[model samples]
Target: MKQARISTGTQDLPMRWWSDAKTPGAMIGGIVSNAFAAIGSNRQRSILTMLGIGIGVAAFIAIVTLSQGATDSFTSKLGFLAQTITVSRARNATNTSLTLSDRDVKILSQLQHVVAVSPTISDEAEVVFGKKHWSTTLSGVSFSYLQMQNVSIGSGAWWSSEEEQSRRHVVVLGTKVVENIFGQTGIDPIGQTVRIGAQLYHVIGVIEPDSLLGNDGIYVPYTAVYTPSKPNQIAQISIQVDGTDNLDTVQTEIQMRLGQLHHIATDGSGGFDVTEAIGQLKQTQQQLGMLSGFMSSIAVISLIVGGIGIMNIMLVSVTERTREIGLRSALGAPPSAIAVQFLLEALALSIISGGLGLGLGLLMGYGLSSLLNVSFIVNTSSFLIAFGVSTAIGVGFGLYPALRASRLDPIIALRSF
Candidate 1:
């Protein structure tokens, strides 16, 4: 009797059970193995559930990334427009050609946020230097026009205020203009005399290739174009503002003031069109935001459908596995373990699908960005948000079915099987 008791001791049984139960890794592994085997039994249903989740998550990521890419492209291209406001001629009832006068320029220069008002005239004409002559587009503008266009003189200097005020015959030539006239000259064109139309002007400065005219630019004093009948006439007026923050206010003020100045009513026939690049950028951003928001709704709907599908499949799985569950329960498996097994199956499907969707989404986003010729923007937040949401969907939808499985009476389940 003593030998039999030693050979069949409960001590070894207790130690084996305790080790398996207390070790979280071993316990979790077992649960995972059971869940995986159950999922493997219904390969088609599991694949369908994963596919649904993948599509939803992929759409969410793709839309956000694509919208950001488009918005970034517009803003980057029009970066300089943020600080500039362009005023152009618009014919009213009285005049066939509307123009801004010297007084208009003076008034705008005094407005808040207005850095400088550059009055300009553009014409195509021939320029002669000594024995050489070249045809180029001539721009008559104030000295401040250089500052407005962010132009810098590569050689010599711009017109002094005194020279501009005195209506002096001075000109600034672009690098290309110089090359066209001087043809790789050994000497700089500064201080040289150039003939524009019937007038002879001195070249006071030369701009590097960085000026608004690029390689083919030429500038003259605004006053040089003034005549007895049109002493202060300008074809275009460019208002350089401080920044883009208050562009609408600045534009409104300019419009109201100009409207009053020109005696045109506000209801119709305003004599000028005030346009800014930053305004277009803002509009683009707003439109892109709306588009992404609309697409996101569709993505969310897909996710909800995917979540519902998971719930339905889990319920079916619980019903089909009644016999196995009953056998496990009769063999001493706890209700908590039964519930966790089903929950793990659902979570595993959601997370794996989410990862697959993330890869597909990134690839889809970059492909669209390339096709649209925009920058590709990677949003890490979208990935985290997608995975997090998918996990929640799994847990929330899987809970009901898990509870049903855990609550089944072993005797009833066994009898059903």
Candidate 2:
């Protein structure tokens, strides 16, 4: 008898593309390698397709980080404003004689939690230094004014209390005044004599650049600006509190005390208005928050557009690999494997793109901070959110195309050119 031959039929052998002895790790390694290989095969198309996601991620990260940096800078730099209060005569006040005075200053100083008080008298005059004459505002204040406004003397010392009491004609020039009067001559402004109207005043100091209260005016003793006829009348009073915690209480006490001093009702009939700096700060922060939200919404729209781009490219990829998919199916690859391969390819693209975008965003945010003269800050949440969103977009947008590819009939797919 002839030797018995073993039949190799479909029913006799299992049609498994992967080996039964292969570990799950090996399967995962193979899938990942194949995904990278497919992406590498078309480098130019992959990079171009990645642009949409890259741009979206970059804009999102940059905007958020930059906004946060700016807000922090603002709060730190101007935070002192929150611990201060401003008292000004209301514009609607009919009594021109109801002016702030030394009495008001004394009362404000003695109030609970009050740290400092400085009265200001504002006027305008033509300042003449040699042939240079520039018209500017004049602020008449005491030595305590500089400390209260967080202003530092850039060049020379502030006038002494005796100089203020004697009503001496000494002036502290702001940066703008120096630029205009002494800029062309390159002259040292300190100890220089400048004429205000018909009177001459010595410049004792120069205000530092970017001073909150001294950028565009000249400062002198309040007694120098106020009429000798009206001894202690002042234009406004600036009050500093010990800390933020006492701001509301101090403001209320100030209003009540001033109302009593002026012999006016405490309601709305008072001649003066009290403005809490913290309120203005909160309003500004709210505006910034709103602006950040609007920009974030735009960034989200960009991400959605990028997701759509991902889906479009994935559908194109599936179509291009029709014959390959059919061949793999015919070779006993399961539909699940086909889906996983495509999905992995999409995920890989997004991961790479997100990384590139994150780097670009950091650079952009740093440049922005430098441009705005603020601090550069990196937020960890931004990185995590960016990467997480990118991965989600890949999976979400790539799923349909992957399923469609897996469902393609091998006979029909193979017929495609």
Candidate 3:
């Protein structure tokens, strides 16, 4: 039986022609049309392959974007802890001694650019309300501590200087403490008696819910919880700089004064250390950046796997359609037309997968963020980069396969099938 010729063009002549490649749009349209036709012929396989690419893209996008959002949220929280100068008791590497005193706070306050100084004494103590007992870290701090730490009272007011001076048994509770003791009653906790350790103290206020610094504790008048024998000793000292720009200078001066007071060498390894809050914030941001980068690297590996899948599928596509290519070439179709058709098919597959993956990724990221109570932030730059890279992968990997189909010998291909 003689084989029938399939001519893309209508005109009959000595040489049969597959198609006229005069218009670029027409050529692209034909390629797209043929690609869809091919996919339609192998519905199950096409769907499975596309799904694989989509899943890979979605996972990559969600993991990378979500991790970046977490890093940003952490960095933002660090900003709330300290903006300028912060002085805390340094642990002795050789020994277990760690102490910062009120005298040291006073000396730090006298330094240039130091606007305010607050001494804090923190100890884990049990609070008793009725029959309920909850263990919480109790902080002894002056009223200035609130302003210095950028914390606000959600209810009632902070302890007054008079209360601190007279050793009054007044306290302020953190949000977690209120939740544990009050259980969402919305009842005023102020004027209520809560026992801390063996001492009964009045709950004068409650702090607003703040995730920054993670110090969900109870605050009391600095003098109220003081041990009379150790009047001036405090666990740490926080110093706020007068201006953001003066933070570096203030931190240096405070460090020098603290080292001199402690009679320690001013070398980097000293008995005490002073940290600028802004410096700590930047360090935290850098660490988060590193984590994000690590996550992106993992995502890249998955994307590469997906790209390889695309290349393998395209190669198979060219092989399966060898007879079609030979027939088209025998009918006078140009090599460029054959190549463009295969390339366009690969491009379409990539675009479809990329779009679906991007949407799924963003949705998954948002869902996870909502579930975890973390922020969901879609990075536009990342989305664009992913799409662009996936498309490029399709073109780059599809090139050899497309060219193979384009360069096939018509007689040889026809004889094989």
Q: Which candidate gets the maximum TM-score versus the true structure? A: 2
Instruction: Estimate the TM-score for candidate 2.
Output: 0.89
Q: What tens-digit string does per-residue lDDT give for candidate 3 at 1-417?
A: 432444323211212123543577766665677666665666666666666567767877888678877877766554545555656556653424545665676677788777777777778999888876789888888777777666667888888767777889898888788778777556668889999999999998888775342436888877777664563357667777777777777766766676677666554245666777777777877877787678767766766777677678878877766677777787778898788877877777777888898899999888888787678888888688768867886788678888888899999877756
Residue clash pairs of candidate 1: none
Reference-based lDDT, each prediction: 0.79, 0.83, 0.72
Tens digit per residue, CA lDDT, model 2, 1-417:
332221222111222224331777766776677677778877888898788888888988989888999899889878888888999888888876787787787788899899878888877788999899999998888777877777788999899879988989999998998999999898999999999988899999998887777478899987787774683357778899999888888888888888888877674255888998889999999998899889988987888888888788889889877877776677677899889988998889888998998899899989988998887889899999999989999999989988998999999977763
Clashing pairs in 2: none
TM-score on alpha carbons, each prediction: 0.62, 0.89, 0.86
Worst 10 residues of 1 by lDDT: 4-13
Worst 10 residues of 3 by lDDT: 8-17
